[model samples]
Target: MLSQTTNAATQKISPDLPLTAKQAQLVQHILAFTARHLTTAGPAVFALYGDAGTGKSVVLAHLFNQIQVAARTQDASPFAHTENYFLVNHPEILKVYREIAGEHPHLLKKDFQRPTSLINQMAKDTVHPDVLVIDEAHLLLSQADHYNNFYGDNQLQSLLTTAKVIIVVFDETQVLRMKSFWTEARLEKLIAPYPHETYRLTHQFRMQASDKLVRWINDFTHQHLHPLPTDVGANYDLRVFDDAEQMRQAVVRRNQEVGLSRIVSTSGYPSTLDGGKHYITEGEFHLPWDQYNYTSTPWAELPQTINEVGSIYTCQGFDLNYVGIILGPPVSLDEHDHLAIHLDRYTDVEAFKKRADLTDPTELVHIKQQLILNSINVLMKRGVKGLYLYAHDARLRHYLQQRAL
Candidate 1:
């Protein structure tokens, strides 16, 4: 296993803050090993896996910047390779890169025109740059294989084959999109060759001093976390308000009471289920991904907010200091009167399959369940301090708390 170090204070140009010591150690190992390999020969496949708000991007930024610095300081050749590329800075790049790739067949190869060239175009024109980093990797493997507007390739393979030195950052918990290559089975297949180098960022730094948040997640996973007691809690400090107005008012009050940040989420609109009372929701919903009146609200843009109240997709590619997740109503946990009461975490495999719409009902559902378990395990472990959960369904809440106990 790779050594672990916290980088909660590493410098960053992006909105991402410093990583924790555990995160820093993982980043150090990857950069150190990657630098050594690039300086020598051959290739390597590396992955930085963690939960949301665990600072994966900060580490990636650190590595990329360091590589640039190393190249300049050491006076090494300008990291040459090929051309025609698609960077994952934003989810939209998936489409932009594809449109650009069609006319340039050379770009399709691994490295997206790196390492190997069709007719050595770079040799004719100019040398292409080497090494590539893809962030928001979980989005690559979304279920919506093709967005209504475009087609996407196996994002992981594209990165692996194209670049001699490829770095992928992803969190299974945030797998709210279509399918790509981040699933457990695909990950197993991809990493089978290099079993020893896999690195997982398990410690969290996004919550408060208490373990309330972490304990809440443990309700589904049958796991346990002992966070230091602080402001946030699963009991009295956290409650399910009547609606958005009350929630926001309480958030404001809490900010004043604790002298800390505060955020609020709506109960969310329901997706009526085929004329049934039970609604079918698309996980949590929120702005940008799901528009609302308050786009620029201070609480909406609060520094520590997770923004997962309405949509999980909104929280992708970013971490939070403290996530105030509001439990929305119209949640559909029963698929023909069946719910995974045993699930102690949000990403439970059985629960995930039960919620997903798959073709082969049983088979797809089974796979989805495993995927959900993987995701929940990752998401629950994200908060370093705590996890606070409030389910409108008293039974679900009771079940969750019992599992936690």
Candidate 2:
């Protein structure tokens, strides 16, 4: 069984839960920022920047809960009687937030919505919320996505027009889709006109790995593969398997020992949204991609998801006790002994959808490669207690095994 602190279903925003000193201080700062700008003319932006597993979501959850509680219950509070909404683009994450909402009186499930849904609904109602908190703001569509029912040029710009104060948690590395692509420069340019404050959380609150190991993962994600740290698995369970099946077996053992362990992969293999099982087959390892989750429960929390290989879609922003990562065909080692990303081997077509504003061929290739590497980075950082790895490319696999010794 998963511990209370590590369990996804329970480790959510709660009014009674205590925050870390740093998290509390940041929440207070945001509260003060919202109060100072509530009566201002334009939208005020409070941008919280952090990497995955830096307790970013928890901070948002706590901050939003405080906002709602003050608005609904505390008459003397500056946020009293203000309308607010919490938005996230990913469906799986939105589900988790909505489920968290159900347990609290001030938090309503309706208050938590997809970014596109909230934008369209607010426009239709001709109402502007006083406060809007966005989790996974990187997932917001940077361009108009008609298929997702967001016709606005930029979701953030649209939300800025519809809200008095907007609080967003962003991480550039977690940007997965072309439609939702974001960078520090682009984000800074967009918010230049607004009254905004930015804060970056640097602490690694999710992974139990040492700083050296964390640096190793960061270096690997940036196309630099160095030898593993000498004490790689001393404090955290780190392993590189030559065989994919063996890695899966190790992950299974970890799951049986401690819940919330699962295998995840980067973009490769046959994957599509056709409502059929797309198997990821290695030499002796075979498992289907994570099916579309119909229930409100987060995908990683489901007991049966242990049998499925989670992709970026289902696993982002969630924690696991142990993660077995399959560095797919897109990931390999080049002649210079550096990690190389092959765009052709990347099977997630949605991630590479063309954007009209981005037309330079060289720039497009760079962005695609970066996004692929970003997915690997996200998967690698999912494991709170341990991380296991297997590469599809023979040379890359050999390189990792030799370096991990």
Candidate 3:
């Protein structure tokens, strides 16, 4: 039964999904809007945005599955009046959907690429489905930039042109690649025409109330964001450790003993030799950002992705349960007293050459510190329940604490 306060078309939340109260409310609105749009005729679209690990994808997945199941039911159900197709970025999801569809091959078509083809097939094959749901919509923007013809025009633009009803899931803050197509300006343009139809997912479902990392990030970005708790949202729990090993151990302890899901591990090295050790280590040090798909694995010798490893470059646009940040040595503050550090250089001659011309070592230090700080801010927010920090150096930990205050 729909609540008297909310839209009547909203779907009731099922018990299986562990959604927060606020998230459940939003899901209700999304489903309601979706049902309304499916029967309205012309194109309709919905947008959902939130912090990392906030269960945005999970809710969308549940709703998509629910829609498909609802469509299968008789004329008594709300969804029997409309047809639905769920499109998502993760290839794993497609496999799951295929399994769900089973031998009734006519209801679902696998290996289909074109949106037009998918929508057309759904119309011809189904009684009333015209709704399409796509997750990781930000990635679509990036893909559209590179392969514009694949989707033709931007992906969002194409969706508006094709689908009778569309739902998009994205977060503007998590744009990792510099070449992403969806900018604040572009999103503004897209939404200016439709004010009442747009919605936002604000409540954090994953991180604990103590997670203050996101507060600092939004402060920097000038975006007004808050976790569930009002006070913890003001400060960051910046823990300092002596080295990477110690940080890893602390993370393991947090997971095993404290029972936390998300922790961050960060490590930094100087890019150029200035007042510190400059040459690359002759020993077996794992290079950051290995090209061939950096999958998570535990380092028996050291703390790797034993949990989940998200580097400064790759961690953008993604969130995990727990994050362990390995703060590599050579981390320092710039003359301006902001975060700074040295970074490892991949085999990019031009980038390396640019690094060599640091007349003012202070600028390089500040840049490094800010980059790592940016990564840390993003990583810490990924945890909805809690944030644990293991700083390699006590002095640095003290500095972090002081700065966070």
- TM-score of every prediction relative to native: 0.58, 0.97, 0.62
Runs of candidate 2 with Cα error greater than 4 angstroms are 1-7, 12-16
lDDT by residue for model 2 (1-405), tens: 544324464464444567889889999999999999999898999999998888888888889998999999999988999999999888888887887888789999988888888888888985568999999999999999889998989999999887999999999988888999999889999999999999999999889898888888888878877898867555589998988999999998888888889999988899988999999999999999999999878888888888999999988888888999999998888888878788998899899999999999999999988899889889999998999999999889888788786
Query: Model 1, which residues run further than 4 Å from truth?
Result: 1-25, 39-43, 77-129, 142-144, 148-152, 193-196, 209-215, 218-237, 240-245, 254-289, 292-310, 320-322, 329-360, 367-390, 397-405
* Best-to-worst TM-score order: 2, 3, 1
Local accuracy by lDDT, each model: 0.42, 0.88, 0.48
Per-residue lDDT of 1-405 in model 1, one digit per residue for the tens? 001111121222222346667766776787666655564444466777776555666676555545544554545534333232324634222332333333343334232321123113333544343456666666553332332222334445534543456677766555542243255456657656642256676554454434555454544433222322344443324343333444444444543433222332222334322443322233242222233323222222333332224233333343222334444342223433233422232321222422243467666644544444344444333333323444445544444445443
Worst 10-residue lDDT window for candidate 1 reads 1-10
lDDT of 3 by residue, 199-286 (tens): 6667565455443445554553332322223346432234444444555566566555433333334444333323333322213322
By TM-score, is 2 or 3 better? Answer: 2
Q: How much is the lDDT of residue 157 in candidate 2?
A: 94
List, in order, the clash count of every candidate structure: 50, 0, 43
Query: Who wins the lDDT comparison?
Result: 2
Ranking by lDDT: 2, 3, 1
TM-score between model 2 and native: 0.97
lDDT of 2 at 170: 93
